[model samples]
Target chain A: MTEQLVIMVLLSFLVVIAFGIILLKDLLVAVILSGIYSLTAAAIFVVMDAVDVAFTEAAVGAGVSTIFLLGALTLTRRQQKQQKHNNYFALLVVTLTGALLIYGTLDLPGYGDGQSIANQHPQLAQHFLQKSEDEIGIPNVVTSVLASYRGYDTLGETVVVFTAAIGVLSLLGLRRRKREEDPELDAKRQCRQQNEEV
Target chain B: MKYLALYNYWIVVIIMMAGFYIMIARHNLVKKIIGLGLFQTGIFYFYVSLGKVDGGTAPIFVESLEAQATVYSNPLPHVLILTAIVVGVATMAMGLALIVRIYEKYDSIEEDEIKAIERQHWQENNGEFGISLTAPPTASS
Candidate 1:
């Protein structure tokens, strides 16, 4: 469809823009590009018929992550220096792995034939697509699968989120020390806050 | 052709994984974050693709139950992906906040420099003067 073509082109553009962000010298623009990247992904999700995902992408990608990256930038050097030299050995290893992965994909099922064995096995999630209404009280089959028969998996996923949150807290949420005596840092903090408010 | 859709998705994945590899291997903090975002985009693509049934209509409902019986692409993936997008933003925000702190403490986000400083601290804490008594032959020797 024409729409899918547009989505593909847009995805390519977004990837290029993301690369530009990384390749740029300034850290600030890199952080901003990260937000743009997230927004683009959100838009792509929209074309894919994934409204829920798109919403989350926009909120987290554009809203919160950029703020965090900028803060991280403040803690880092303003500009990254060019690498000392390219390591051919590392590049070789990466290329070899990539080649293998591409080769491996030849075995994968083609786009939704529905007759693919992966689609038919009883163990497959097709039950939800077929006989869920009489069993699970929910209309959304994915939700039913996520919350009911796979409750344990759902619980594991929750734990994963909890662990991720803990990691973020430990990694990022350090409490401020008493800045009363450190006039230099205190002044810097005040200036930063002022810029933020404005 | 029908196969074109599959190829399109694979291309998306390849680009995504490339970004992920950069994140994992690159020392530059900003570059790493860029990689992370690209990797996430790939995942978004995977979820969105899952909902694609050929000739499928949007998940929107019509008043006529009979008309609604026609095939429509699944909407559930879209909903799920939306939630993930929100979470991604939160994670990115938190990550950036950490990067700020890292910059403040180390004054450089380059992994090598941070590691060097950390090693120096570790050495001081452990009081290692040079090589350990039972260490293997040194390259210098």
Candidate 2:
């Protein structure tokens, strides 16, 4: 009961933060609030027995992503520009989507029902939990499943991360090459000015 | 009790829609990326919630399994979501890098302003291919 109450409070905080992120014009504050949002979500994850996920959310979502946003902010404007026209179309679209999703959830198993299909699926979740000790020899099912059973997925995820790093480096690296070329451009400009004077 | 059971899903829907609305309605590129992060997190929440069992513990194995039967929350979703969280951060980083490059090119990070600048360039160039090639790179405005 206490656990549910705590989760309820944290989830409420998440809603409030979501509203804050939407309504606030200051990007820096929004970024900080997003970190708080991730931390709150992490807390909820912990309550839901998702400790590993909570760890990753706290580290990656709250830590690295916040730093990335802050680094980007140094390069871009902090204030969101005010537009003349209201976005009623966006509001309507969001409302419609939310209503549809909520209606769909009515058919889903109740929260934390142990016999839910996802929990009892013999081939997938059950197979991992029951056989991971014998096949993978790892007590932590998530790690075994991630590193052994789903090795290809983890490999692909690593490749994706590496590609993103390379993409970011190449995208931001253009400035350094342009900087190296500046002396030549400056010298050429000086020659043009001198020739004009002559 | 029926409605209460679906509370988590309802919250997830709200958060996802908030992110979706921010992504589409906001002009700021950074804000849009933040919205994208929120949207991804909402999905993560849904998966994790699905894996939850009323009385189950985390998926780690116990020392004495034969002593007492234990219920472990589904580990598959946790594994999937772990990979997803990493991918999410990578996407955010890539998006921010693109935003920086866009700012450097057009001197603005707002989507509508960037579009307006591009349109102006298109009109000035009259459908030519060398739009950015002709204009000297300007310092940050």
Candidate 3:
């Protein structure tokens, strides 16, 4: 009962944070609140016993992304300007989609139903969970599945991460060729990069 | 009982729809990206909830096989979500980088302002403006 109460409290806090992210006009406050939102989400994930996911949420969502958002803010305005156009069209689309989503949820099995299709027909999952100790010798099924059974997927994910990093570097990283062509522009670029670094 | 059982999933749906609303309604590019992050987080929660068993413990094995027979939360979703979380961060980083470049080129990050600038360029170049449209005005001169 106490656990349920704690979950309820955390869930309500999450709702508040989500609303703060949406309703806040100041981009900086929203950004900081978004980080808090991630932290709260991580806490909720922890309560749900997803320690790995909670760790990643804390590290990536709250840690790295917050810094990156601040970096992006440095180059952009800190406030969201009052939108001049009516968002009625957006409201209509959002309402339609949200209703459709709610309708689809009606068919979904209840939370934590062990006999549900996803949990019952666990052919692949069974292989990983049951045989993981003998085959891969890892205590953590998540690690074994990630590193062994789904090794190729992990490799692809790594490649995706590498590709994204390369894309960012090409887009915003210092350019040797451009720097060589114009010394004055190079100096300005250096100053900005130094400021960002600090 | 049914409503209580499905309450968590309903919350997930609400959060997801809220993220979708933000993505659609917000004009600021940064806010749009933030909305996308929230949407992805909602998905992670959905998948994780699917893996949670009513009385299962974390998916860590102990010494004995008989002990391992105890119900364990499905680890598959957790593994998948780990990869997704990393990928989400990388995508967000790349998006922020692109936003930085856009700010540098347009001197404004507002979507409408960026669109207006593009429209002006198209008129000046007779609709032939392409990648060069991103060039700073001073650079073109």
| Top candidate when judged by TM-score against the true structure | 2
* Candidate 1: true interface contacts recovered: 0.31
lDDT of each: 0.61, 0.86, 0.78
Question: Interface RMSD values for the candidates, listed in order?
Answer: 7.4, 5.6, 4.8
Model 1: C-alpha RMSD to truth? 8.6
Residue A91 lDDT, candidate 1, scale 0-100: 57
Write candidate 2's Cα lDDT for B35-114 as tens digits.
99889999998999899998889999879864799989999999999999999999999999989877665556777666
Clashes of each: 23, 0, 0
- Model 3, A129-154: lDDT tens digits are 67888999989888888898899999
Sorting all predicted structures by TM-score, with the top scorer first, yields: 2, 3, 1
Chain B TM-scores across candidates: 0.76, 0.89, 0.87
Superposed model 2: Cα runs more than 4 Å off: A174-198, B64-66, B133-141
Superposition TM-score, candidate 1 onto the true structure: 0.72
TM-score of chain A of each: 0.71, 0.87, 0.83
Using lDDT as the measure, which candidate wins? Answer: 2
Kindly report the docking quality category of candidate 1: acceptable
